[model samples]
Target chain A: MGIVATSFRDELLAAGLLVPLGADGLYGRAAAFEDVVDALARLIVSLGAADGAARIRFPPIEPRSVFDRTDYLRSFPDLTGAVVTFRGDDAGHARLLAAADTGDDWTELLEPADAMLCPAVCHPLYPTLTGTLPAGGATYDLQGWCFRHEPSVDPARMQAFRQHEIVYVGDAAGARAHRDRWVERGTELLADLGLDVEAVVANDPFFGRVGRMLATNQRDQELKIELVVTVASADQPTAVVSSNCHEDHFGAAFGINTAEGDVAHSACVGFGLERVTLALLRRHGLDVERWPSTVRDRLWP
Target chain B: MTDDVIRAVLAEHGRLAVDVAALDPDADLYQVGLTSHASVNVMLALEDSFDFEFPEQMLRKRTFESIAAIRAVVDGLTRAEVD
Candidate 1:
């Protein structure tokens, strides 16, 4: 790691914001960090409460069948984490114990579970809404701990992280408008919280050669926007929030229709709680008490 | 020569859904399915083929939106090199 990343990690560890789990991409959040995360979540909900979105929370794991239907494995096979269990007989268990005693790999005895870790917060929402919508449409506010298989030491990119998303499921215009509105709102919210943030046109990390085309198409169409803040490096800012427009992709896939029987277009604005908290720590020093009074008031008061 | 070189590079490395020969030079490559990831490949191929690095400003979507746009950037970079 470079000087900046190394120092940042040291500062976080010293301040109790991050508790090292002796594993890459895994860290336990201390009270101060969790407080910031919870405060941000409350702030987000307060900002979006008027939208009348049906709030739903989901577990970190989702059905494998539902995940397959979303085509996430096809697009991001490298980042999908499948949940597995030990389905061994007593003899097999004895061998597994022996392997554990010898510190050998016991993963061979594990079997794939019915579910995989949730890749995106919105993945489980579509299948549940698989039908015609009301006249105008429906909106959802979902938050959960989402898991991805990318293991990295970068504090900003965690293998297990929390995501809060306000998803719009409706007509094309409504969905587009919802995304646009949140883009502005999110920028203002971050700014008000005393963080420098910019919303830029961006693309998802698509897989393989064909995925390259998908990323370009996404950018060209302005289908995705990211709220970026300078965390570890000013030159390479990290994206803490993302606003995406799915544009009937999910509607068509899940058979969700509008009142007129047309496929519903969808959009979502997602905030990575840990990334936001890290951004706050990066902007204002690690000491919560020493942060700007206004930021402190917003988060604590 | 530059146009032919651009076409050849894209054909060899673009991983495009459609034939490079069939694409309109001015048409939006992204609209036709040139992905952002593939665009990076196209950029690298152009840089290797022409022996020049693209400036940071030239890395946006507009710089590679079409075959014509890519040709323009390459021409400008090569011209700058010669001058």
Candidate 2:
């Protein structure tokens, strides 16, 4: 098997921006890459600063109990990741070691962990937000590491990534307004950074037979929209930012209520840090210093 | 007959808190406690009972909004089968 260096991912690896692990979708970031990601995160915060969104951060893995309440497993079982750990005794451990020595399937010996990798940044916050809200509702500035099990060589799609999200939980009108505003703002922000960007109606990759209907329904209602940019190819653009209106889905799931005694509607705008960085690199070049003056000033200045 | 089957399917798979039989044909199922997650179950069950697959065009929320909507869609698909 010969690995070619013609791909964008290969170029990143060659330029020392991304350090590849043994896996297809997993990688370590070099200092230069980390700096770009950090700058992007800061830019996101600055853009949303006027909104007064309360900042919150959580670890990548959330409790399985909370994960069970979400519809992720039902809709996206293909992308869901469940944490498992070894809980075996001495005999079991010895067997596991023996299997490891012989290169057998030792993962079967592991037990289900109490945690699962969070698929979205806003998911874990819903549990804390159960109960009624105040007058105008709440807005949160959240950033976290999110996980999905989709392994691909696209480099844009990673198993592990960071999301900087602005989440609003309130009435239906407020939620939709939040999503709509963000759709415009997010597109402008990305476009200003020197990328060819567009906001388009999009749907989640819902799973299975019934999921097809759900995807169509979602698109019909315009519940989700994404700001996409060409990262890998001209034909296929990646979603660098997305605005979604959950429309009481999370409120119903987590029992969150509004000031008006109705189930609260939730919306979020998530910016993919790594994807945007990659988009910038693809648009400009791997050398950050050599980037267009406008782009450099927007990020570093 | 189609309405009865839709009702029975709703009773079994809708997981709704309300009684499906008592609701009006135009009632919004989602407002009556039917969730998006449960709606998938309802959609699959409806497919099983009708023995017809829903094309992408007919898979909107309006198709499953009420008993009448479900009945209409089912009738159209099965009638197409007869044709």
Local accuracy by lDDT, each model: 0.85, 0.88
DockQ of each: 0.15, 0.48
Query: Candidate 2 at residue A24, lDDT?
Result: 82
The prediction achieving the highest lDDT against the true structure is: 2
* DockQ leader: 2
Isolated chain B TM-score per model: 0.92, 0.94
Q: What would the per-residue lDDT of candidate 1 be over residues A1-301, giving only the tens digit for each residue?
A: 3567667777898878899998767899998899999999998887778788888988888998889888786568899899899888999999999998999998877899889999899899999989999989998999998888887667887888999999999998999999999999899989988999999999898886446656766887899999999887787899999999987778877999999887889999999999999999999888877999999898877
Clashing pairs in 1: A212-B35, A212-B38, A213-B35, A215-B36, A216-B35, A216-B36
Q: What is the lDDT of candidate 1?
A: 0.85
**Per-candidate fnat, comma-separated:** 0.27, 0.41
- Two-chain complex of model 1, DockQ on C-alpha atoms against the true structure: 0.15
Give the best candidate by TM-score.
Answer: 2
